[model samples]
Target: MEEKKRSGAARYCTVPSCKNNSVRNEGYSFFSFPKQTDRALIRFTRVNYYLLKWERRNMTLPKVFVDIVAKHPHKVAFYFEDDIWSFQRVDEYSNRVANFFLSEGYQRGDCVALLLESRPEYICLWLGLSKIGVKAALINTNLTGDSLVHSIEVAGSKAVVFGSDFKNALKDIQPKIVNLKKYQFNENIWLSPPLFDDAKDLRTCLKEAAMDAVTEHIAKGNLKDHILYIYTSGTTGLPKAAVITNVRYMVMAVGLNKMVAVQNNDCIYDSLPLYHTAGGIVGTGQALLCGGTVAIRKKFSATNFWKDCVKYRCTIAQYIGETCRYLLAADDKNLVKHNVRAMFGNGLKAQIWKPFAEKFGIKEIFEFYGATESNSNLVNIDSTVGAVGFVPFYARFLYPVSLVQCDEVTGEPLRDVNGRYITCGENEPGVLIGKISTLRAVNQFTGYADKVATEKKILRDVFNEGDMYFNTGDILMYDDFGYFYFKDRTGDTFRWKGENVSTSEIEAVISDIAHLSDAVVYGVEVPGAEGKAGMAAIVDQTRSLDLEQFAEGLRKHLPVYAQPIFIRLMDSVELTGTFKLIKRDLVVEGFNIDIVKDDIFFYDVKTKRFVPLTRELYELIMKGEISCPDNFD
Candidate 1:
């Protein structure tokens, strides 16, 4: 829903849902080590939310086309839970699907909405669309109401393949779907126990269309053809659809295969949602390019993860930091059973890097740094502690990036007239900005209807000329050896539970509770953290706060992903001259809960209420002696 826009300093909370998003300076704003003055006015406006710079992708995804048929046509390429398909078989089936669509008059660049979740058929649909240059609009499963409706309209999808199970959810707007040709998903297979029977049955319905005619159209497909649309989690209020060209897919595939050492026989185990880039780009595209094997799980199951790894004999598994923490907490005996030798993905924290590696016997760890809209990327195959990895050139071709001094009130970065910002010397931390060369800018997107979305991501006039560079929106500290260490993400997004936690989503539920006028939520370091812990800084309505009621209320309404673990109750809220909650101070204070001389309250998950953070409880959490659900089962 729409909310009021606060004036001047008060406007901090006006960017959609801010009360639940921002960090309060009342006594617990997140701490910052800002450099000296002489910068532009930097009052806390919501972190520049939209600026994303996706580096240029390879113009074409590495293709097998006629070559793979000559190479390893007989080897199995796809194995469903119940059925297996060889490369030659998949080649024919996808061709059939591609042919079916073309016979139905489908053309290149047409938008086809995919409502199916993670399954073998979903991948087939994606690959088949790629063969014909059609775009797949991967809709977020969590979207609802107007947001869900708006996503389809904005994408202008020509047709929707809605999962049979989710079709009823869209019944309200089904009749109103304009420019829509058909709504087909699990027409029969998405029913009953799917024993690879759905895909098998789908072959029959497609038989009416002449497969011979489909051939002429498939020949026109190229690496630069398919447009893959990855929708952002609306945790940022409104999600934007990123345009992924076939070239982008190819680049990631090649880069990941080389960096992660994925060979034709290696298995890639992915439990992450295919809707995400980590799943689609790195998992699916990369595997397809290498002609390797990929085993897909229905979804991420903590208890079932390692078992799946061993079950599939997976060599390379993709992971999120939060997931690692959970895996680390699992019974130590289970770690040795898996054949997983290497792990890849981002958000693996520095604190737990070595311990996790040693515990799980993971030999190679490739931590990469890239957003859907990235200008550069670092793939650390060496498993460097917290380092995103190394960029080839352009970025490293120039100088080091690190944190610097800036105006506390207004966060204007200090750059010189030459358009080059001051480097954070050797072994210093600075804002990591990838130099956007003509080549690296290829993967950049022309967003869905938001002009500001495009402009906000560009930082113009660098190098004394009026050239534009997309900002990474992250802080990186450099060391004496030219290695980059991730400092933090410089926006409202904080990591928790292996996912990006939108500060605004957290604040929305928090501010709704009575007596809580404002809430600032962020991820903080929990001892032995695989990722950040959710912490909220809130304003109490009464001297005798009803924290028990507050905890109960949040527990009832919010999902596990959005809840705050530590609650720091402030006497009053503090804002800047511009009314922005200063986080630097509060981040430094953290949630000492009981140690600090404040009326702070900690939520006891087991006790089911708020209790003062006594020193004993704090030590218990730090020592890893406390039995809690902070980690996965």
Candidate 2:
């Protein structure tokens, strides 16, 4: 007997009385079962017709989830830690949660604050609230003190429900919440403080309520109604609540599935925090809408990531750039043992893109560029290595996105003699702006709950009078090939020696140096200086910075003014829950050795190496006794 090779094309059945074929396409090889009997043909035809109708219907977020539950009632919907919840089971649980809220006199259109970790219950509550037309303000679990109280109060939340892990944080702000009901989940995990004695136990309430579907309330929901209030990351300032309507979420949920070609058998691994848009909307929503499974974790763990993916049979995964970097740094041999074929999310740097994909065995990288509140959205569907997204000429008319020239110092749009903003040419880095109009529904910017903050993001009279555009506050470059590449944030790009300096560009150079785990570049004000000077905070994994080698690398790769004048060496970098670098404190501290305890070094002109910044040299530089190179002024 001889072994046979698999066929790539359709193979016709050779049975004596059968005329069936098997086809291979889109990574799927399936046999087309014969419909020889009349009953079989009728059943297939009816099912196909219904599926077409369902696809054509205009769906909201809640409707999408409900339809998935109806289609795959017994299919596992969520895998959290050691527990599994089926679609039908989660649906039933959400109904009980909704009933419990209604019993407490909570009416439709009410807003509730959600301060919980990534868990199955957090999702159930969010869905239940949406079913009843109530908005859920997703508070960042890492926030505490004034920031925590401001988030709940600013959203006008009628109630606040938190996980047991956040009990202590909630207790500190309980007295200041004023007239709002407080609730806690998983009370068995930890006891609430005595200060929160009045807080209701949501777990007990759900267990006591009937598992009945709130069909009437769900049916009353409008597609345009507010469903979620996701907050900004607050790296620049205080976090603001961004409104997420049902229609917006629907677009994300369905659009991601279509762009990524998600299937019913797929299981998505989502270790990103649930409070963020990537995890909540793209990760969780895509899975639910496709009738797939979601494997969630308390938080991202580089050591346990591949193990969980293999255990849950995950075919897709979500990531941020920092998470991918951590995975690359980890020494786990099980990295290539999983079944993940695709990875989706934003912030995957150009330098790390190809290596991350190849090492992880991911064939597709669905990188996207968008803000939580902004209307602008772009996705790279073809796995364009370094590009965030592609804006084809045909689709540009519909998106209304443009790149405009910006002033480096003011971080504002540059205007010509007519006071009209100038649009950047191809390959020019500029601020990304999306035209705002009621006619272009997809380009609509609902903005933040804070009306003042909402107005601040709008840039009027750009190309023409009476025209308005939403400022993305991000600098990007558009190439001739119709691909958009991220440059840096507006404030992140600073002026030095009459030229604009991109922190991201410099960070990329620093990241290429061996023994350096991470680097954060920013601008710092110098005494008697015209513009801010470049500075960097670096994490040296080797605990010893070879100044000569590091300086040589920077001098060769970076321009004179782009090179950092000062460097702070640290063991680790502080990051937000979503893996965004926390730069506020570092920027404030600057290179002041008195304020910053970290070891600081200054680039010496004669030695061509970085040396310790003693107090004598620091004062001389401040007093004009020492001059920096390229100080044209």
Candidate 3:
């Protein structure tokens, strides 16, 4: 039979009998957040409808990949650096890994930790492990010492597969986890003898192992079985292992593929870390499940993002957190023209969403909202400016998501006299919750590996006596049109000056006024203050922030209580794998000049200006002598 080919830009319904087209392709107006028309309702109703037909019947991701490989063995699956990985090659490589592990007496229900940079081998190792019902714990590469050991130990990993570049990190915890079978592989070239005495060379073992496919019985798993454990960002505290079942993975991947209208020939430019759900699952799903090519980058470079897209002829791209902001800050001369049509992910603020799309010539920006463990998921089908996602009135019954009033200080869901959780009215900020149901895989929440942590997220007797809902830990407000907008994280909103202040709102305003890519906003406890005081941290290496202009902007844009009292000028702000600001350390340091090496400035309320936080001034503020704006209750 002659080989079949499809254009990268080709568009049509994937289901044979279905005639409905994507909202983007059907000429829907891009001006609004909500669509009430029958056409709009029909278009969104088909989301994941095609995938649902076979999703329950499909076994695992590896099985799906094998099927795709059989159909298109020679198709390019991954473009990593200068190398191109074909589907057949990836399958064979994974088979070798599976065979090696099986030969070493590894069996079903075993956990293996993966500590490697973003690369094709990283995916192959995890996929291969999944072939034998072994779960892969995707560890963040940036972690070291105690954090690294905790992540591995929490997952109960019997073995660890690490890149040669991270041998030192493994070595640091090698004594602590002496029982762990350490397997190492070098990205460049394999060492003759392993550099670490305790570590084994994984490449040599794979080369020695057979490349034949494992038998179906040995490689089978229930769709609900856990295949991967993806850790949370640890922005709030220690990272929690969020369980990623095969069914959950399938739902996430298929949902993105269907909603984005991904084509088989489309190339996705993925610059996110492979450990993250956005990069590992959603981004890779475009090519792995939907069929296409994924261009991988070891690290995200704002300067090279566009250049790489152009280099790989990528038709689609991914972004999360401050990625778009960083790109906007990059020198325009280096941002070469590209053929990217659609960009998807979360955290593109409304302030820069339109400008970033317009400047880069992107046609559609599909912003989505979902967490690693939560079942509540939403996607913006229309390019409504600033809308994270929309749950139209017509689709609310299908989605089963609602916003409930929450205590401003404690972040606990507020209940009425009847002991029932109060649902927020339109335009009211509240904690978003998703009703948990086992009928469909999309509405299920697997939660964390720790049962205690898992239970903390479940709200029993939420609306009824026995019903349960997953607390998203996010504050969201939906407009009258049912267009949901992100407000802040539950714990991130601080009480100040007898009012609740949202850190996200302050950060967005500060980032805009500073003309910077990102800013970190948090509340710090003052010695004499009634509540936590607002603090903003901006990355300004030179300490040349225009204090007068910034103060003026703050006065105009923010109220007295919302305005940050302390500003920390840092050389750079630490970010997580997903580009989320790490505020724990900053919050710990607070505004203490002795502890913080960076320059600190205090907002002079009397003068309506900002001045350096000198020792005398700090003492005066600590002693409650410094005059300030209205005090908190």
Assess each prediction's global lDDT (C-alpha) against the native: 0.60, 0.75, 0.77
| Top-down lDDT ranking | 3, 2, 1
lDDT of 2 by residue, 1-633 (tens): 011113212111221111233222221112332221222234323433433444356446678788888888999999998889999988998888899998888888899999888988888898998888889999877666656787898898999998777887776766787588988786344554333567887887899998888888887877678989998732234467898987667556666676556777899999988988888888888655667799999878888888999999999999876577667766866465889888888777666777677777777788888878877777765566667776654446646799999975445799999999999988899999999976534667888888988988899999999999999888898765456888766655665553446676677678776446488888887764545688999987565778789899777656576789899988898665523236656878988878987889998877888889999988988885775655211
Candidate 3 weakest lDDT stretch, 10 residues:
1-10
Best by lDDT: 3
Name the regions of candidate 2 deviating beyond 4 angstroms.
1-58, 187-195, 234-236, 334-336, 492-633
Give the per-residue lDDT of model 3 (tens digit) for 1-633: 011112211222221212233322222233532233353355455655644655657667777778888899999999998889999988899899988998888888999999999999899898888888888999977666655787898888999988888887777667798988988887776345355767788887888989999867334667778889998732334467899988788778878777667777789999988998989999887666666789999988887898899889999999874577667766778878789988898877776776687788777777888888989987776566666786767567777899999986557799999999999997799999999988777789998888888988899998999999999888898764456888866666665543446676677778778887668888887764445788998998776679899999776656566789999888987675523236767888898988998889998866888889999999998887774465211
Cα RMSD to the true fold for all candidates: 12.8, 14.6, 13.2
- Model 1: per-residue Cα lDDT over 476-527, one tens digit each: 7653323466766666666666556667766776777645657777777767
Ten contiguous residues with the weakest lDDT in model 1: 36-45
Q: Would you estimate the TM-scores of all the predictions?
A: 0.75, 0.71, 0.75
Clashing residue pairs, backbone N/CA/C < 3 A, model 3: none
Backbone collisions counted per model: 39, 0, 0
- Model 1 error, position 335 (Å): 4.0
Query: Alpha-carbon error at 40 in model 3, in Å?
Result: 6.0
Q: Alpha-carbon error at 515 in model 3, in Å?
A: 38
